[model samples]
Target chain A: MSCEKQSPPELPGCQEANGPLDFQLRILSDPRLLAVVRCTVAEFAAVSGFKEDQCRSITLAVDEALSNIIRHAYNNRRDQEIEMRLHADIGCLEFTFVDRGEPLDRSKYCAQPLDAVALGGRGTHLIRQIMDEVVYERVSEGNRLRLKKYLPPARLTP
Target chain B: MTHLLDDKRDATPMKISTRELNGTTIVDVTGEIDMSTSPGFRTALLESLKKTPRLAVNLTNVRYVDSSGIASLVEVLKAARISDKRLVLFGLNEPVQEVLQLTRLTKIFEIRKTEKEALEV
Candidate 1:
């Protein structure tokens, strides 16, 4: 099993205390699945104590991640298995995407400049903006992409 | 190991409702616009372009949009500019606004806070 873990601050509902509040999803590499997964991510963020706007940003970030995986990693090969794991705690929310497809070239990753009028390549840029930490690793038969978003301190205040 | 939602893939079809006001075509879209749905959006937008030179895309009801959706809008915007037409977008929720901001596209498009202002632009 491929796993990419986020280093979370000691907070309530962490894995050691509340098992990290996780859900595993296995969906075919299909664009039709993006909406459902986005909805699920929104719910996850909302329940994880994120504000409404934050929840929307988080959902878009994860959706872009999955879209990149389907388009780049799997090369748009439908029906291929893609595994996703969502973990949340009081401190942060993390998403891990595992795919048994092509390894991404790290050197060529660049988000287009904002002033430039273009499209179809803004995923990485959006992900970096929405998430606090992003890590990618190549495994034996697949690749792992991990995204983490730290909860706002104001939201955590009781 | 476990699937959360049921297999309801074919449930919601993206709907684009268009109307004419003040010689501008207003396109109100609702539903997710990712790879599966951008084609329809592109077709609708292209058809709408044939009708009027000024277009306003109302995304107030749209909950989600991926890069492909953005690509469709960009294509239409380029076409509109080449033909000396005007395109305006308004009522962008936080998520939609964030996506545009992150991609540095906020400056490239004419964005308004409400339909009234979008029409005025």
Candidate 2:
């Protein structure tokens, strides 16, 4: 067996000029990285003025995304990094993960409906069902997944 | 910016917040959510479920979350299913998404593209 390192490219979605909030991290594809990203998310949300329940959901979603890269993408090998971005508008949030390696099975990700006791195939399925918008862009270099969540727009004028 | 707070040793650089949208509870978390902190994440989500049937989680602010966090989520998702409540996860950062995809548990919960769609579910 051989270990190879593939440097990640500059991810596209993070540079949004008008997004209300955003976070970007050059993360090593490690289980520990999930915790690191978790901390980042918590801090970001706190500063962004998200409520506690909103914080919990955001943390959970972030955990699932980063863990997938460490455990699957690099197969827990110490060779690659998962570039990450988290963004929040006034009433919405966005999470994007970019992989520098090969592309994933697009059709295989059917966005399965929720069912208890089902074993696998729930990763992309869940992401698709939960986020308000889910978009996948397959670039020449790698794959980029963008997830968005919107709360009801605040009624400040009222 | 936080360095000043660290120097003063008087300010907590991170915090947590939650809100109810329609029938769903939305948590926009921001902090270092690991083993110790993940419990807070789990508790907050679970606690809200006791009061509401719909739950939407926005992961746009969370910077870091650990395996314990994942475990906590699995529990939350399981409980939500058992109670017949609708819970959806939205706005997953890259690191979070990778973890879910690898564990093959991403199939277990509803992760939508945006909060708008999640609430509609």
Candidate 3:
């Protein structure tokens, strides 16, 4: 929590020449902050060498994850706190979200049938579709959601 | 800059404006469409559908859209189908288009590249 602290200990190996190319953002569960967070994620993804389209997809996946945390985990309460950490390298980008809210049900982890034109449970579906790996764990205090998007090695165009 | 976001951080979260062109209802959506703003989008869509069967959504300015947002649009499409109406979309930026493609909803919706083409449909 100290302002002088640069990066968390968990992200040691992910540092770069300019220092750790990682960011940790902590905010209340306010919907207004969504845009700022999305912008930050997009910029971070761009810095990690993702293409513009890939950055956008990463942003949307993170947005949906945060929205689910705010709505389902906190039950639309804006007073709760949510923490997001971004770690990236040449091969992949990982996002970890921690929230002091309700635990997610294991039964709801699966994507629902898309045949019906219903509005429920599509957030997780999109998250699964956009990200290569999605992991959810319930902690003693709340929950943790980790999403990873794989980036293939850059290819040379002859 | 944060100010760009500040400009869009209004009391009304998402801006959904509508106009008519050549008998087609065009809904112009600006700002992020997520869980918080999808309700307003639903209202705008339902209101637009009440007036006409055909709805054309212009999403050029939408910076972000999550699954809930997509669901709202799907709800609109479902209602349109049941009511024997038509729904066409144009001006979808890359992110929106990618989401639709990933969900396989692109094949389900009538998408065009231009408003003129959408109106002609």
Per-candidate local distance difference test: 0.80, 0.62, 0.79
Q: What is the TM-score of each candidate against the true structure?
A: 0.83, 0.48, 0.84
DockQ of each: 0.46, 0.05, 0.41
Q: In angstroms, give how far residue B95 of model 3 lies from its true place.
A: 1.5
- How many angstroms is residue B72 displaced in model 2 relative to the true structure, after the best TM-score fit? 12
lDDT of 3 by residue, A48-105 (tens): 6666677777888898899999988999999899989998754678999999988887
What TM-score does candidate 1 get on C-alpha atoms? 0.83
lDDT of 1 at A116: 62
Among the numbered candidates, top lDDT falls to 1
Tens-digit per-residue lDDT, B1-121, candidate 1? 1112323334675889999999999999976788789899999998898789899999987766777888899999999999899999999986677677767678779999999999894
Candidate 1 lDDT over residue span A1-158, tens digit each: 10111222356755464346899999999988887787788777766777667777888889889888888898999889899999987678999999998999676575456456675677787788889999999988699999999987876663
Compare candidates 1 and 2 on lDDT and give the better one.
1
Which candidate number has the best DockQ?
A: 1
On lDDT, the stronger of 1 and 3 is 1
Give per-residue CA lDDT, model 2, range A1-158, as digits (tens).
00111111234786643346656888766554554465577556554555444554555556655655555556657568778888766666788889876566655555444343443444454455446787778876577777776654552111
lDDT of 3 by residue, B71-113 (tens): 8889998889989999988999877887887666888889999
lDDT of 2 at B19: 93
Tens-place lDDT digits, model 2, residues B1-121: 1211123321332356789888788877765555346667888878987888887878765554455566678788888888998888888876567556545567777888788988885
